[model samples]
Target chain A: MAIVAKSLKYTKHGEPQDVLELVEQKIESPQAKQVLVKILAAPINPADINTIQGKYPVKPKFPAVAGNEFVGEVICVGDEVKSVETGQHVVPLATGLGTWTTHAVYQEDQVMAVSKNVGLAEAATITVNPCTAYRMLKDFVQLKPGDTVIQNGANSAVGQAVHQLCRAWGINSIGIVRNRPEIEELKQMLQCLGATAILTEEEIRTSDIFKTGKLKRPKLAFNCVGGKSATEVSRHLDNSGVMVTYGGMSREPVTVATGPLIFKDIAFRGFWMTRWSKENYDTPERKQMFKDLCDLMEQGKFVAPVHEMVPLDKFKDAAAAALSFKGFTGKKFILDMSK
Target chain B: MAIVAKSLKYTKHGEPQDVLELVEQKIESPQAKQVLVKILAAPINPADINTIQGKYPVKPKFPAVAGNEFVGEVICVGDEVKSVETGQHVVPLATGLGTWTTHAVYQEDQVMAVSKNVGLAEAATITVNPCTAYRMLKDFVQLKPGDTVIQNGANSAVGQAVHQLCRAWGINSIGIVRNRPEIEELKQMLQCLGATAILTEEEIRTSDIFKTGKLKRPKLAFNCVGGKSATEVSRHLDNSGVMVTYGGMSREPVTVATGPLIFKDIAFRGFWMTRWSKENYDTPERKQMFKDLCDLMEQGKFVAPVHEMVPLDKFKDAAAAALSFKGFTGKKFILDMSK
Candidate 1:
């Protein structure tokens, strides 16, 4: 039987509130090696917004469906599919799955059958932000017990995830954020997530972090907001430490003084989850990383917070709410397709 | 009986040609656990110039002798000394034993005996430059047969050492130098040292190396000249590769664009021989490194090209010869301390 479904599509690239449209389309039967999935819940992530606006490198083919991560239930299997059984919940491995639809079809290998104990909303937010945070910490620098890492944009989803993961690994973290009027409240929130210390960008700039002295310096620095924030983080690292940059939210270029590279021997590196996942698809290390993350989630060491659930017809409203500063205070907006 | 020795001493820090004085003094008896050595040969390296200017870190307490590396003969040993025999040729194991005088005293354990097979000139230059080249290649990056490494200052002592060692390991090297009137002669000289490709800084900037769709890029870049040369080398690296910076000849500073660090995930690092040797002293690894370097030298894989040999009294002529800008040439000015 044909499955008639509706999907949120973008005809042109722009702000999420302006370009997204909900339209009915015919979902064909699964081809060989494909599995048809009913997308049960999907979260609105910052990367998803960037993907829709065509700002990110991993852009979907135009007139594209624009969602990277979601939780779904397998409704039907193709002729050659045997890995995932019908009626099981799953999450797609990476971007380009376009999960903002009532139903979707993907190759059997591209989907992972999740444990029944994890809730749909939590699973929806797991594949991107948490994985990115975990990989960035573990891959770039070898962190020993009591070793410290510092990062800016400490109030974002990935920042909270990094804090919790570092805590689990017996490492310390210093979080940096912009100086807002609600900084005290923000500090409390980050501390609750296991941040060892929190500071404002202005404080880091005015301090003696750069003047060579015996101060406690971080061994690794995570940067999301570029411009002066990156330069400041570079200054606070010990000799031979690394700075791994993933995002540039301020849309400013990352500038570094040559003295640090020449005198102190610091390293600069980058990380992108979509690119890493795509490149390491068939490697055993990739498989082991996924298994490790799943184990962490099963042990209750990791958690994904959902801000609000919106229906498919209210997709535009959901996108706006996700992008709005007022509604998404430490919460991720999820789309529930059941309605 | 005391040894009557003539030594060069600097009463105060000043330019190499100005304040240095040659004086005759009576050498005291060797203390317990000390050995007296007669200096044979030493090269006036760039670091020596910096030392005489009092610009190097580890400055001598004033009125001090000024060379760091040399070949010498053990003439006498203190009553308590056991390991080193008198009349054997030895080299100081880098530090505290200034090598600029006719006769000096040191602890028996503070020296390494050189084989009769290796010439004194070769042993004089071995302690720093060749060891740096070896450590930088092996310690930081994993090299495989057919992998390419590019470096600036190809005519430098360290750079020439790298070219020969890379060739021995079946690794390829692309050497960069400043444009000179004797460009053809320079290219031929580097080629004889086993450089696979040679290019001037200007040719690289105006070439198609950075154009899109190029099939080959270097797996590692070694930067001795900072500023524009470093950036140009960085532009030609494959994704996730490393650029190791050890020297800054241009004095213009190493500037890297943020796009490579954020998107391509390249790494930038620095290496210092003084720090490495001091930190890893007496380890089996350090001993093995020296042995390997000696074996390479014995097999004729490494050679120090001396341009001029000067007597101790001709110190001004030696300094001028070392600092001359005669375009693409070998190391100049060796001190024949025996004279």
Candidate 2:
């Protein structure tokens, strides 16, 4: 069967709202090793916006699909496909699977059969930020129950995931965010999401949580906002700690004093979700991660990020909203392709 | 026999020369596990100066001896001392054993009997800087014989050792130093010691050594001078490369861009010779490191750094010269305590 599917496509990199256009692509039957899927929801993540702006590492050729993550339903499978059958909800096992479309055909291995237990927004963001938080916490340092993980940009999508996961896993978390007029409300929101403690960037500079016996110094630190914020988060890490950088929202560099690096034996490293996904796809570890995350959702211990759902046709407004943190809304934009 | 010895002593933290005083102390005979040694030469290392100013991590109480490294001749050993015999030469096995005195009694195990094949300067300086260069090269990355290492502060004492050791190990080394009026001369000198390529900091900012096939982008980079210099050295590291910082000569924090750190998988870490020595003090690894370094010295593959030997009474002048770059002289000041 042939279907006319509308996809948000970009011929070249530019502003997401300026360069993206709705184009109709011919969707054919799944090849022998492929499966056809109906995309349900796709989020305009910062990485996706960066991809449209040509600022990300993974760039597809011209006239490429405009999104990298989404949740979809498997419509049908080809003769050689055994991974999923009809009516199964699925997502890409790795990144670079453009999801800003009504329908598409993908090779069987590139798609993961995710459980139907998660909500549309949670499942759509399963592969990027959540996986980043998961892998960084698991891979870099071993955190026992009650151990702490400190992070900056606690209001980011990844940070929200980190908070929930840390809570579900019985870990303590200290969050660093910028001081704002509505910070107390934001703090309350994140605390509900599982943040053990929250402090503004300025407060972290003078916070003696470690010294005053309020919280154990973090053995692991995650950084998204760079510059002075990154350094301040690093300063509170425990002896022989590890600080991992996953993003630079502040657009500044990570600066580290020689004292902590030398005297405390602190190690500085970077984690790229795209790279980690590409390397670990199809591995048992990746499978276990999805299973665990889905189990968390099934148990109602995990919830999706705060988001505003938009129809596919209103992608321009979604893109603009994602670009401007629009009045510090703390809300992600999920394009509801089902409409 | 009782001995009257002149020792450089400091009572409190201040400038090295301003606080140091030559004091006469009567030394007693060796205790059961002690060896009495007559000091030969002690060079004023930067760490020693920092210690004198109470800026280093390992600071002694007030009225402490003034130096950290020296070579000495064993004058006598007690009945239980099996490490060294009378007339044997030795150096401290680790830091914090002050070495400025003409004669002192040391616990037998605190010193290592070194071969007389090395010169006074080389033997006196065996425990710190050279060991720093040696351990950093061997520990971080496995560079096979033909692999390369790139480093800044190439005219530093550790850099000189790194050049010679790389030569002996058949590894290529690229040096980055400041561009000066005598740049060519410094380049020639380092090239003689075995730098595969030499570049000024400014040239490295735009150099294409890696791009032009002049040298392979190093898997290992050594950084002593931090800030932009550290950033430039880090920029040339190969995929998943590691940069180790041992000294912050510029007194600036190490700044790293999020791009290389995330995309290229570069890692930033610090190396402290004091920490390494303290951890590996009684281990076979320490013994093997010293043996390998001395073996290189014995084969004439390593030479003493450029130095000026001053009599013990001229200690203040040596301290002054050590404090000042004074026309950027590379010659280290060694106090000839034997006189």
lDDT of 1 by residue, B1-339 (tens): 779876777877877778678888898888899889899887777777777787666677888877778888989889998878888888878674667678888888788887757777777778878888898889877888878788888888888888888888988888888888999988898889888878999887776643543325777888877887888888888888888888777666666566677678777788778778888878888889888878878888877753466888888777766656321245656778865
Please state the error at residue B38 of candidate 1 in Å.
1.7
Scored by lDDT, the top model is: 2
Which number leads on TM-score? 2
Give model 2's TM-score versus the native structure.
0.96
Residue-level error in angstroms, candidate 1, position B30: 3.9
10 residues in a row with least lDDT, candidate 1 chain A: A207-216
Error of 2 at A147 (Å): 2.6
Residues B1-339 of candidate 2 have per-residue lDDT tens digits of 889988998899998778988899999999899999999999888888888878888879777898888999999999899979999999998677778989989999999998898778889877887899999999989889888899999888889889999999999999999989999999999999988889999999988788977667799999888999999899889998999988888889999898888889899988998888989989999999999989888788887777789998888888888888631235778889876
* Shift of residue A5 alpha carbon in model 2, Å: 1.6
Model 1 error, position A260 (Å): 4.6
iRMSD values, candidates in order: 2.6, 0.7
Docking category for candidate 1? acceptable
- Residues A1-339, candidate 1: write the lDDT tens digits: 888878888888898888888878998899899999999988888778877877766657778887888899999999999889899988987568888999999999999888867767667878777888888988887888788899998877788888888888878888889998989988887887789878899887777643544335788998887788888888889887888887777767566555566557688778888778888876887777667767777777767753688887888887777777533245778889955
